[model samples]
Every structure is written in C-alpha cells, then in structure tokens.
Target: MKLTSYWLDTVPRFTGTPQAALPGQADAVIVGGGFSGLSAALRLRQLGASVVVLERDRVIGEASGRNGGHVNNGLAGSFTDACAKLGEDTATRLYKVLNSAVDTVETITRENGIDCDFTRCGKLKVGNRQAHEAALQTDYARLTVAADPEACLLDETQVREELGSDLFSSGLLYPKSARMHMGRFGIGLANAVLHAGGLIFENTPMTGMKRTGNSFEMTTPQGKILAKSVLMATGISRNAPAWFRQRIMPVGSFIVATEPMDEAAMRRIMPGGRNVVTMQNIHNYFRATADHRLIFGGRASFSRSRTTTDITSGNMLLAAMRRTLPELPDVKIDYCWGGDVDMTVDRLPHAGQWNGVFYTMGYSGHGTQMSVYMGQRMAEAMAGMPDTNPLAGRAWQKIPCYGLASHFLPLVGAFYRAKDFVQEMKE
Candidate 1:
C-alpha cells in the first residue's frame, strides 16, 4: 500500500508562485499555508489587503490534505458536556458557528469554481454500545432543540438502514454536514489566492519573528519580510512561541483508503453517503470518496505522526475498520497516512489576537471546517471588521507539563482502550 494521502495523490499538484526574491513588505503575513492560511489569504486579498503566506512545506501538505475528508458541522465532543462547561448560550453559539463554518467552505468552493466534489452528504454519529443508544438519542434531542434543527435521531432499524454494519445501535444525523475532496479544495483555494492579489511562498518557513514598532519582522531562510499585521495560522507548529505551544497538543490521527469498491457494495455500506463517526472515546470517522473508495480514519494512537508510527497506526485502523464493518467488500488498501491534530484541553477551537499577533488554532480533531471559517473571520477582523469570533474570550489554559505529552500519551491511550473494553463488555 502507498504510504501517502489518497487526497493529495489523486489531485493535480499546486505549482505555487515562481521562486523569486521575497517581497520586502506586505500588509499582512500569514505564518502557515494550510487550509486556515490559504482561506485567510483569499479573504484578506478580497478585502484589499496585500497578503503574503509562508509555508514550510508544500501547500496543504500537512493536516489540511491529510484528514478524513469530513467537513462535518457541530461540536467534536459531547454537546451536552460543552453546554455544562461553557454555559448553554455560549455552547449553542459555538455549535452554530460550526454550522456556519461548513457553509463558508461550501460557499468558497462554489464561488471559486473549485470542483472538489463538494456534497452535503450529512453526518451520521453512530452509537456502538447499547448504552450509547439512549445517550445518542439524548444528544440528538438536545442538539436539535438548541443548535441544529436539521438534525434527527435514528432508531435501530433506521440506523441499520443507513449503515451496512450491524455494530451500530443508533445514530444522530446532521444533514448540514458535508464532505469534499480535500486535495482539490486545498489546491483550488491556493489558486484562488494567486488569482486574487495574494503572494504564497512554498518551502518557506518563518524561523523568527520580531516585533518592530508598528510592524512585525519575520525571518525565513529565503529572506526577511515586514508586515503591518501578522496572523499565526500555524497549527501545532514546531517553532511556535512557547506560550502557544503549551496550549496546543499535537496528536496523531491515522487513515487508510480502500481500493475502489463495487458501487453496489458502496451503496450498501453507506446508502445515505453520510460522514460516519462512531461514539467511542477513541472512535473512528469514515466517509466514501467520490470514486467509491472508503476513507476510514481515527485517533489510532496519541503519539506524533511519523513514518513508522503511521504504518503501525494504519495497520491498527485497517483492523478496526474490518471489525467495524464486516460487510465491507474485500479490497486492498490503496493509501495509508497520518497527521497531527492540534488538540486543546477543552477540545474546542480558539481564535483572537495574542499580544499583537492575531492567531487561530487548537481545533483538536474537528478542524476541517472551523479552521477555514476562523481563517476568514480572522482576516476580516484584522481588516477592522466586527468581531465574529465565537471563541473569543475563552481562557486557553496550557496543558500541564506540556513537554511530556509523548511519554504520557501512550498511557492515556491504554486507559481509554481499557475503558472502551469495559464499556463493550457491559454491553
């Protein structure tokens, strides 16, 4: 099997702006060229700002192109828990913004004529345990009443009809959720940024940043640049300030894409063509690609993503996939890969100005839509627009002993696995 992202392998490569001398100054300098950076660059240009984006690797080479391809709406964790922790009104607002985030992605795709196979396939949160059936129903009731009227609860018969697997007991359906070809979207957004007046430099990493009165001076290997405003769209950066790094934990998520399956089998497994996520502590999320390939992924491990780790995690995911869906047609794995998720303690995204630098990140694992949405909003906010940030005033606490995440993550993983085992046994 190829050890690369199926999304990136299938789409046309983005040949960014020609290698040239870096501009001396720009109105705004974006520190990362992932979805958030590209989205912000596009919007900033639209707002008549001279924008420059510096990417350490190829555009969209990281988490943006290496995700499960679900542009799902709503909170990544329990909405009920979010309400209790963030207060009902705040949680509801945060949930609604995610719905808006999905719409923003769709709008950008349509407006830019990005043929990324964007589809409102909706999302199905499957419950894997007998107890989860009632819990999911309760979540559905709470979600529909507070945040999403487009959501519905699925009973056992109805859930089974939507899924080919018998493992799921019930489901929560969010019709506003969508999926798209992430590679195509990333390339399209980059092209849109170029089509506008923005400048993007690939293979350029911002190694240093100094606040020069009224402007920030950024140093890269290519050259130095000055910007009146800076947006740290960098997610889980290896070179980020210690303060930023402490609040964000980089967790590895692995995925595997099956060879194109029979259309009949595909329909059987995913009749509704919905993004599927199971209700487990270390749950899996999956969706069928436009070409009928099953793109399955999960937090196979909490370790950082690398070549060896990716292979090990990919094997774990394939095994889990087989167990989760016995009805899946026999097919070889076409692609396997992993990426680091910018996880926060609260499992929510935070965006606002820090000191003098504007930043957005900490999406945890549910960043696909929020990253893009926050990028645009941050750009607009930088352009002196009204604050549309939902996560603006939330205190971002540093992860305790953040430096030792690697040593402890495996233990945490073990504990979660035991918890899941006990839960399954009870069922």
Candidate 2:
C-alpha cells in the first residue's frame, strides 16, 4: 500500500498557484493553507481585504487532506459533560455554533458548485460495549434536548439493520452530519480564493515575523510580505508560532483506505451510507467513499507520527475493520498515512488575536467543518466583526512542561487503555 493519503491521490492538484513574487505589502498574510487559511482568504477577499496565503506544503497537504472526510456536527467530547463543566448556557452556545459550522460547510459546497460529493449522509456514533451504549443514549438525550432535534438513539436491532454489524450494541444518529471528498473540497476552496482575487503561495513557509509600525512583516523562504494583520491558521505542524505551540498538542491520527469495493459489498455492510464511529477514548471511525472504497481511521496510538507506526496503525485499523464487519474478508489496503491533529486542553476551538496576529486552533478531531467556520469567522474578526467568532475571548490552556513533542503520549495512551479495560470488565 502507498503511504499516502487516498483523498489527495484521488483529486487533481490545485493548478492556480500564484506565480508572482510575494508582495511587499498586503492587508493580511495568512500562515498555513489548510481549510482554515484558504477559507479565511476567500472571506477576507469578500470583505475587500488584500490577502496572501503562505503554505509550507501544498494546500490541504496536512491533516486537512489526510482526514476521514467527516463533516460531522458533533462535539469532540461528551456534550452533557461539557455542559456540566462549563454550564449549560455556555456549552449550548458553543455546541450550536459547531452545528452551524456544519451548515456553513454544506452551504459553501452548494454555493461553489464543488463536485466533492457533499452529502448530508448523517452520522452514527455506535457503542462497542454495553456501557458505551448507555453513554450513547445519554448523548442522544442531551443533544436532542439542547441542540439537535433531529438526533435520536438506536437500539442494537436498529443498528444492526442500519450497519449490518453485531459489534455495536446501540448508536446515536445525528441527521445533520455530512461527508465529502476533502481533497476536491480543498481544491475547490483554493479556486474560490483565487476567483476572489486572492494570492496563494504553495511550498512557501513563513520563516519569521516582526511588528513593523502598524503592520506585521512576515519573511517567507521565497519572499516577504508586510500585512496589516496576520492569521495563524497553521494546523499541527511542529514548526508554528511559539504562542500557538504552547497551547496546542500535536497528536498523530492514522488512516488506511481499502481498494474500491463492489456496490453489493457496500450495501451489505453499510446500508445507511453514514459515517460510523465507535465510542472509545481512542476512537475508530470508518466510512465508504463516493467510489465505494472503505476509509478507516483512528488515533491508533498516542505516539508521535512515524513511518513504522503508520504501517502498524494501518494493520491495527484493518483488524478493527474486520471485527466490525466480518463480511469484508481479505480486504486489500490501498493507502496508509498519518498526520498531526491540533488538540487543546478543553478540546474546543479558540479564535482570537494574540498581539497583532489573528488565530484559531485546537479543533481536536472535529476540524473538518469547524475549521472552515473559524476561517469565515476569522475574516469577520479581522473586518471588525469580532462578535462573529464563536470561540471568542476563550483562554487557551497550555500543556505542562512540554514543547514540540508530546513526550507523555504513551503514558496517556496506556491510561486510557486501562480505563477501557476496566469499563469493559464492568460491562
């Protein structure tokens, strides 16, 4: 199997890269050309701002391209617990904004006419063990009452009908969840930015930045830019701003894609055509592509990303896929890869200004849509619409005594595994 992203391999490369040398002056210079940075450029142009996007790699080359293509409108963690921790009013507002982010992604797909197979196929949060079923029911109860009236609980029999899998005991179905071809969406978003007269510099990394009077001066490998403001939409790259690095933890998420399967096999395993995710501290998510290929992904381990670990993770994911769907025997993995996901202490996205730089990060594993929303919001914030930011005025919590690498990941993974073992025993 190729150690590359199936999404990136399937879509055409973005050809509209800017050929001009980086301008000495721009209204805004965006760091990182993932979904957040690209979407921000599109919105900033609509607001009549001259924007420049600087990407260290190809646009959407990192976690944005390597993801499982879930535009799911759910929180990364439990909603009821979030309400209990932050109070219902605060949590409800944040939850609703994330739900709106899903709507924003669908709206963009429609408005741009991007043929990314954007589908509101809904989402199924399935329970692997018995106690997990109770948790799913709890999430269904709280979410339906708080944010989504379209959410509901499904028993084992109903889940079996929907998924044809005996591994899950129950599920929580969120009807607003969606999926799409992320690579195509990324290219489409890049075209949108270009169509709006924005400049994109692929393979250009921001090397340095300093305050120059009213504007910030950013030095890239190819050229430099002076901007009235800067947006740090950089994903979980180890080379990022110091302020951002302190608060964000880069966790490696791994995935493997099976070769295109027959329509009959797709129908037998996943009749509902929804994203299926099991409830676990270290979760496993699987869904079929528009081409009928099953893409399975997970936080296979808490260790940092490496070639060997990616292959090992792919093997583990294949085993999990078989356990979930015994009907798919001898499945051939066509692709395997890994990328870093930026996570926060609270596991919620934060958008605000640090010094002269506007920024957003900590999407955890739910960035597929929320990052896009934060991009639009960052544009609004830069255009004097600070209230548009859903995660406004939130303080970012930093990791203790760690920088760059998460040295304690294996210990954290072991703790979660032990907890899972205990939970399984209790069940």
Best by TM-score: 1
Alpha carbon lDDT at 150, candidate 2: 86
Q: lDDT tens digits, residues 1-427, model 1?
A: 9999999999999998876578999999999999999999999999999999999998999899999999999988878888889898988998999999999999999999999999999999999787888887778788888888889989878988898888887889989999999999999999999999799999999999999999999999998999999999899898988889999988888899999998999998888789999988888999999889999999785554364787788789889999998888788898999888998888888899887999999989898899999999999988889866767888898888889976788889989989999989988
lDDT computed for candidate 2: 0.86
| lDDT: worst 10-residue window of model 2 | 299-308
Q: Model 1 misses residue 59 by how many Å?
A: 0.7
Least well predicted 10-residue stretch by lDDT in candidate 1: 301-310
The digit string of per-residue lDDT tens for model 2 on 1-427 reads: 9999998998999875646888889988899899999999999999999999999989999888999889998777778888888898888888888789999988888898888999999999988787777777787788888887888899889898889777788888988889999999999999999998999999899999999899898998887789998999997766787778888888888899999998989898998899988887777888999888999998785656474787888888888789778888567999988888888888888889898689987898889999899999999889887478878777788876756347888788888878877887787
User: Any runs in candidate 1 off by more than 4 Å, and if so which?
Assistant: 301-307
- Model 2 steric clash pairs: none
At residue 23, candidate 2 shows an lDDT of 82
